[model samples]
Target chain A: MDYFFIIDFVQSLADGLLFGTTYALIGIGFTLIFGVMRKLNLAYGAAALAGTYVGLGLFLTFNAPPFVVFLASAIGAGLIGLVVYYCCFRFTPEAHPMASLLASVGMLLFLEEMMTHVSHGMPHPYPSVLSGATLELGDIWIRGDLLFVFGICVVAMALLFWLLYRTPLGLATRAVSQQPRAAQLCGIDSARVNALTFVIAGVLGGTAGAMTAAAVGILSPIIATGLTVKGLIVVVIGGLGSIPGAIIGGLLVGAAENIFLLLRGVTERDIYVMLLLFLFLTLRPGGLFGSAATRD
Target chain B: MKLKSLITAGMISASALALSSAAFAADKTVRIVGFGASSGVVGIFGQNSGAAMSAAFEKINAEGGITLADGSKAMIETEYYDDRCNAEEGISVLRRIASTDALVAIGPTCSNVAEPLFGILQAKVDDAGDTGLQFPVFTDVAIKGGLAGISEWVFRNTPSEAKMYDDLFAWIRETYPDAKTIYGGVEEDFAHSRFTWYSVMKTAAEAHGFELVGEAQWLLNDTNFSNQARGMRRAEPDVVAISAHPFTSCGMLREMARQKIQPKVLVGLTSSSSLETLSGCANEAQGIIIPTSFAPVNDEAKAAAEAVAAKGGALDLHSAAAWENAMILRDVINAAGIEGTPDTLEADRRKIRDGLAALTTAHGLLGENKRMPDGEAVKPYVFVHAQGNAWEVVHNPGS
Candidate 1:
């Protein structure tokens, strides 16, 4: 009996860790977009679903290798991001953050609708990028997919950090994000920075979408809202503009929810997660990370 | 003066003919309405079912419709209503049709949406107290067995899950006696999943001498599967069963993968034999076996599935049923030979219904045979195992 609970606790912990990878990835997508624009992207998760649809479409069409399908899906979703930027943000009054936020939500719905129309609400089977092999580490069974996903998330976040902090484009983007008028005065076209930010963020969203679908091996429109909510929760809990915070929050939430469910039933799983979010909202809205997003 | 009278007579005769035809047209038209989930991901089933029904009608028209005892034939005229798979919307749509002249109605695809809506419909169909609406409803895809609440007028053409699972567990006991513990989870919110996991599975497992180590529920829109996956892992059953629609099922499987929880055998719901399952967890779902009515292994079935895909529709067990049902319905119409005009519409409808109920077995375009009784059919689903990224027929039910 004692051994059973031990197995139960450890199993739940491992399961939570695996899901944390996906949560972290989704959080990163939201954080990447929000960090530069100072605008919350409701469509970030939708963009991911759109990408999974694209990837599946390509896979069905060509029966090509999985890598090719994943790449195509990523590119397709990136294109959708360009459309979001052009239609929702580019034409909007630059100073109106509310317009940008609402526009992203509209774009989310539009993309979700397009996916529904194309597939007629049938889920597309996504092929995983990594082989779903397992390694039995004594009492611990490590899923190769989860490990790969976590690795990918870590690598993606690191690369993004490097791009944002080390590159000239990153410097320009930072300057624009901090002070758009001042950046413009310095001959840095804020429009270009914003456009690039949208495209890059879209790429991240697409990758997250493709990877998670591939990990699970399916995609559907309903996931749009879940991903959006999880992503937002991670962003908020991690401190809006903090990349590391988003990653940390994603993993934290993922583990916490699983642990909660193991102790309680599934009905109360979300309640605990929401409470955790509430705790953050009430106590430290700035999150564990110092750099928080706040509208002027 | 005679010439003027003759011309006047001709003009009056033409007008009289046109007016008489218009007046009698409404009575002659036998209107039937179909409601379905036409908006979301699962909407493809409804869409294809509509197409198949139309095709069936076309074939009937071509071969001369239901022939009455009087040698008269009347064609089936159908109007489709998009329910969007919402119970509220389905209720409104059903109500709209209930008030109209639509004699017999079919569908509101989602079983989750079907429960309460069917209740509202039951009152209409089964009010012996003369208080409820009077309409005969035969749902196509709603698989709940408790549908006969109000009256026997509510019929279903769906294969009973209870019977299907019973046979399956019996077969499993006979085949794999050594496989002991069964651990699995289902989408709790969906009625299909809930009943499948709790009722049908528990009953079947107990009867078949297998013990259920654990059962868990994952919500439909849930993206993470840590708790459920962990439960399955903790149970450490020899076999792990998943009773979920494609999306959430795959999500749980990925979580299983993340936790590195692998059982000797993996089992899945019949509905999981779709493009969604293959795409979502292709690698993780490998070797996970399921029984399904439709497989594109046969030439004709393969061609039909491809044709649907070409038309941007994914053909699975459900869609395959649409195709097979269409062919059978067409055959019934051709066999009945009901002859023309509005007066014989009731006779034609009754004939179609009877013809469908009487069919014991139908030759399917696919290799599997569909066994029918009182309108519903049990599909001959083979034991299909997930290999890499696709469901391959591991055991041919043809045996």
Candidate 2:
């Protein structure tokens, strides 16, 4: 193989892996919610972006700092998550799985339309904390914002792991996911736990949104729907309710997407992705870390 | 009994007068309906187009409107619908408009929507073989070349991108004699971006003695351009031409900055010559040149720009074309001696279509636009470059 090919391959992989931090962040939100509730929140991406839009609004309205913007994004998305929970999942019976799913789909459209109306479908420039910073590692270059995103993802995931394993709320959430009746019998409020789970996932989603916008250096309503789809794909490939699986799946997807794009082109990149999804679904329905018991 | 009879007679006379006035008003109003994507990724374009149309119509109405077939003063009435940039929605809107008392229609902003929507129109005029919708569509936006030739019933006011890019590259070759190598990029998912990049931009650049060094592609919604920027950096081209809408174009430009890939010259798609690009990435987009059909260079253009801005819209090439389209429709209504009434709606529509088709040249915001044989317009254009968050004209070929 030519030296240029090796260099190109390594660069593409590095690019994809770094960009995959966004996918990982979004996937974590999906996995966390699904792990606790055993249900999909289709409006997750929209809610997250809605929070980002709130952050953008704050920036535009008050000239808020990047840290404040990101914090506002998380808090705002957490609030919207509660709203989504109440509207889409709270009233619906647990027995009717499709009801909550359909309601979330409706919520997705509602959020997208609402944002579109508010912004007039205009792309807003996002304030990046690390703007135009890059590190040159020999011939391959790494973007400063994306590296910041990667760092944020790692710190967020570490905190998430600690929260899930080392807290009373975590025990209650695990109990609820494992057995709702037992958790309820043990004096745990399953409804409260479910709502809290959504808030947590929403907070993560908000962080993901802020990071994504900051990395891209622009925010628009266009990314909401596509983010939702990518998040779902990551969730499925990462083994549904498995957080580790989500991370791995996100990185794998990112790397594979870039490599495919480099090799074939954009036209067939998505096809390869879908085929990979099919392979996982057909051969290992439980995904990398998902037990068969988690399958619905 | 005599007093009651007198009062009854008075009421009858008053009713007769009111009825006659209402009928006369109805006869002297021409209604046109337009549909476009008012709620999607590119929804802003449609909104701007709609606003410009409203502003133009308002101005026409304020200035005594159009003269009718019987020398009566008739005002123009317009209605706009949101197609959401969807082909099915566009077709549905067109069908609904066809059933209305509207004498003509406008828009279907996206080329993807316009292509299939135009296919539904009657292919040939008065053809006994083709059973398509017999309505007039005056497009203001969908700028993919050769769309006007799809049907006899459809006409476009959009500029020819092919000609624009050809002139642009020629100018670039003359202006920057040392710029020889060109790198290209496109949003592959969009019809306009893909066609302009592959067919117009590449052909023009090569024809002007520029060698193709590398090319990259991305989706309209894609936010990342790292790999593409790396490739561009490797190619080390003198010129980088990107065919994309404002969103992806800004994204790519920002990525290029991050990669430290500074090409000597930058050429952009015709559609990116707008305020959106500036608002999105003014710093990144600086020095990128694009050819556009409209600029507020003259008094009339300035007034129209202000009018559009008053209506909360920017006067870009697309929206300016929409404003010009409204004026052209007015002239067509007058020249065709249209009878603005429900009874003559179909015949009036046919007359408007014929009038539009028969035109050789029409007044544009910048200058006179030649109406081509295939129902397209050859609009006058100028080259503008992004500088300090604003597009300043660099060259006026006409001048």
Candidate 3:
């Protein structure tokens, strides 16, 4: 191989891995929504970009200290996620799956348009949370904020595990997701549990958006759209409606994207990731960990 | 003064009569139609540019319509069309403007659009024996210099990025000889940014002793810049030249900051001088140096730009060129005495065409034109270093 090719290949993987951290966060958001709501937050990516805008707007206005800006972004996107649930999912036809997808897509456009309108259809600069505070470890260098973001994602998912398995609210939420009519007949108030589950998913998405903004430092409508696609890819590869599967899928998507870029190049990089998704969908329809246990 | 006015009047009418005396001799009203991009993403730039031209035309009319070849005068009339900044749409708009009884055209913001429009203008105005379509035109801002060879029928009032960057690098070398070893990526999808990034900037850097370190090409719609950033870090260049628009550049710079990679000397092109840069990159965006044609902070240019802004227009160095362009067009028209009647569109366009091509220098919105030997006007540009959260004018290389 040419020296240039070798160097480019290695660098491409490193770059893909670092970039995949953000995608992992986005995947987590999609997984949380699917696990709890049985719906896709088409606006999930837009929520992230919108959260970035929220964080950026506040930062611009208050010139607030760093962590406060991150909090603002998280809370901002989380609140928007709740709104998307309210507007797009809450009163939807029970039989129509496409209704939720279409509504989420509409929310996606609305949020994107709102962002463009506020920022003059231009990209807004986002201040990084821990930009200059990274540590270099061995052959591979780890970015501090990305490290923090990945750590936070792990923690969030772990806490989500605790809530689903251990907490009473989590018990009710699971019962509602499993058998809504049966849970209602059992007097569980499935709608309330479902709404709360969406709020929780929204919070995770909002946090993901905040971390993504800090990691990337620029937010555009394009981010919202890309995140949605990546989230779907991760969800499909990981197995839809499976939390653990979403996690595995997230990491796999991240590492797979990196390795793919390594073998091929930037242009062909996404092709493999996409191909992997298609392959998984065809060969292993239930995905790596999907089971009849997840069946409604 | 009297001889100048008399000559201006005489030239105007003679040119008007030469176009088609039978058509204009019957009508007192003269139409001066305008064509340009009025909607879409860059709609404002196109709309404002045409409006700037019309503003000048309005003042000319208030003083008295353009004097004909005889002592008589003809009134000013206008028509405006929206090109939507689309290539095919631009061609259709030109066809539409040609159909209207309007003389000459202005606006349509980009070179890709303008390049095709130039071909159309050339075939109809210059190459086709002045039949079917023959209207004089003035280019406001389409930064690519490819059109210089399009036709003698076409002319630009703006400096090409090649000349601008060449001068910029020359000044940087003269001022900071220590700067060397450059690495960066250009926005490949955009013709203007790509051509400047790969061709003009690299050539200029090579000539100035700056080593070509590395390169990555990003598309216009690219949001995530992980792959590109890592490439730049691996390159470890002394200077990073990112030639892209705000959305993409901000994303790239943000990733660079997040990765904690720092380069000693960072330089951006003139086009990057915008409020959007800060809005996109924030704190991580600091320390980057960009050469800009105008800063609202630049007293004279600012005052003039502010005046335009006050009249419902925003002024950046890029947009500020419209004022300079309009004033230059006026000087050319006044000197050449372009006939403005609808029928004289052909003859008047030729005068306008010759006037623009003949202009060595005219007063600009900035300082003196200071025409170079190569016929390019060296507009004033300054190096503004992004300090803290704002851009501070660090060097006035122009002076």
Candidate 4:
């Protein structure tokens, strides 16, 4: 390859890594819920976008800053996560996993339609915290917004790690994830753990959504389904319930997508990404960091 | 005394008959159905167009409505339905409207929906074996090329991108002779943007002596444009064209700015000449030119814009077509000389269709709209550029 082509490839890699932060955030939300209940909350992406819309509404109404909007989005998403858990999972008999899955899908459509109704399907500009600011490293350009999103993702991942490894709630969550019956016998309320897990995942999803909108500088109702599909792909390739796997899978997918986009143009880019997902499913069913024990 | 009583009863009966006939004549209303994505993604198009159509109808009714063949004025009534920008919903709405007393139907804001929706319409005007609905469809928004040729019953009051781009390139060649090379990317998933870019825009640019740069096609709703931006920056063309919706357009433009892909000229899809694009990326979209059929620069367009605004709609090119279409409907109805009655609804619809087919031109907000042989309009358009959070008319090739 020519030097210019090499430089372009490196730039693509860097940009993909930055973009991967969002996928990781969304994947983490799915992995967390799956880790707790062994059921996928398909409405997670919609709830995340709904949270962002809520943040947008607050920002428009009160002229709040970007940070305030992001905070509100996280909190709003957490509440929506609780609602989804209650409606889709809490009362449903776990005998059929499809029931909860179908319920979450219904919830996803409801949230998307609700947003479309409220926003009138018009795309609104999300406040870019550091728009038009770029850091140049020789031949490569780094977007300031993407950098900020990357930083936020790192901080969020660290906080999640700290919460999971250095807190009593973490202990309860792990116990429930490992053996719900045994944990319940030991007087640990699995239901509370699951609900709390959903709340945490929801907050992550909301922050992801806000960060994504900020990165793009525009938010619309159309992002919900696309994000959900990406999140699902990330989770499956990262190993269904493995947190670290989700992060790795997200980066891998992002990098692969950019590389494929460079090679085959946009029309064929997603086909390659989907093929990669299929390959991973067929060859490495346990994912990069996951083992059979991690599988639901 | 009995003969006098019989005369009194006869007189009373005659008065009752006259009053009933007068009431029937007063209640005469001409119905038109409008359907589009009024509630989902891209609902703004439907909402705006529906509002503009309503405003036009309101003005028409206030100005004595439409005079039918019998010399009686019949008020125009519109029923708007939400198709949600989906093909299934588009067909559903078409079926429902076809079963009504509507003289004509308008809408379906999306090209994807329009593609299939137009297919189910009667192709040759009266193909008995086809079993297609013989409803006259006057599309306002769906702007994919050649859709008007799908059925004789279908007509579109949308800007022809081929003509618009051809004129735009010719104007660009004259205005900026030094800008010879063009690098661009299009949102491939969107049918309108993709088809326009592949069929009209590239060909027009090439015909106008502009060389194209690297292969770059971006997906619709793509948030990241790093690879494409890098490619464009390397090509270092004089102009960069982007065919995308406002949301993706803003994203790509922002990325281009970040990557410092500064070209001498920036051109965008005609669909991007809207308040949404301005609000989404005001700084990034600066100096981006687009050809638009509707701008508030002209007095008539300004008045129509204000009217639409008053009715809670923004008058962009797509929505502005609705206003012109409503007036065109009135003109066609009058020209067709249809009797406005429920019993004659089918015949009246055929007359309206034939009237629309016979129309060679209609009055547009800007000027006279030229109708193609295939029931499409060649609307007068002006080149506009984004300047500090607003679209300003930069060039007017007067009609």
Q: Which model scores highest in DockQ?
A: 4
How many clashes (backbone N, Cα, C below 3 Å) per candidate?
26, 0, 8, 0
Candidate 2, residues A55-153, lDDT tens digits: the string is: 999998999999999989988999999999999999999899999999999999999999988988888888887767878888777778888888887
- In terms of docking quality, model 2 is medium
Better of 1 and 2 by TM-score: 2
Give Cα distance to truth, residue A169, candidate 3, Å. Answer: 4.4
lDDT of 4 at A20: 93
Docking class of 3: acceptable
Q: Scored by CA lDDT, what does every candidate get? A: 0.71, 0.90, 0.69, 0.89
The segments of candidate 2 whose C-alpha lies over 4 angstroms from its true place after superposition are A294-296, B1-23
- Listed per candidate, the RMSD to the true structure in angstroms reads 5.3, 2.8, 7.7, 1.9
TM-score of chain A of 2: 0.97
Off by over 4 Å in 1: A1-22, A55-73, A94-98, A125-130, A133-137, A290-296, B1-29, B67-72, B99-101, B122-133, B150-153, B222-239, B251-267, B273-399
Better of 2 and 3 by TM-score: 2
Instruction: For model 3, state the Cα shift of residue B231 in Å.
Output: 4.9
> Candidate 4 falls in which docking quality class?
medium
Please give, for residues B1-399, the per-residue lDDT of candidate 4 as tens digits: 999999999999999999987776667799987899888778889999999999999999989889889887789999799988899989998999999899899897999999999999988976778888898999999998889899999999999899999989999989898999998788888999899889989999999999998646777668787787778888999988898998888888988887778888899998899988887788899999999999987798888999999999999999999999999999999888999889899999999999889989999998999988899999999999999988999999884
- lDDT, candidate 1, A1-296, per-residue tens: 58766766776687677667677777876776676676777887898778777778888887877778777777777777777888877888867888988998898888888888887776666676554577676776666666776677677677778888999998998888777778889999888888888777776777777777766667778878888888888887888777788888888887887788878878788889999899998999888784734433
Between candidates 1 and 4, the DockQ winner? 4
Candidate 2, residue A35: CA error in Å? 1.6
lDDT of 2: 0.90
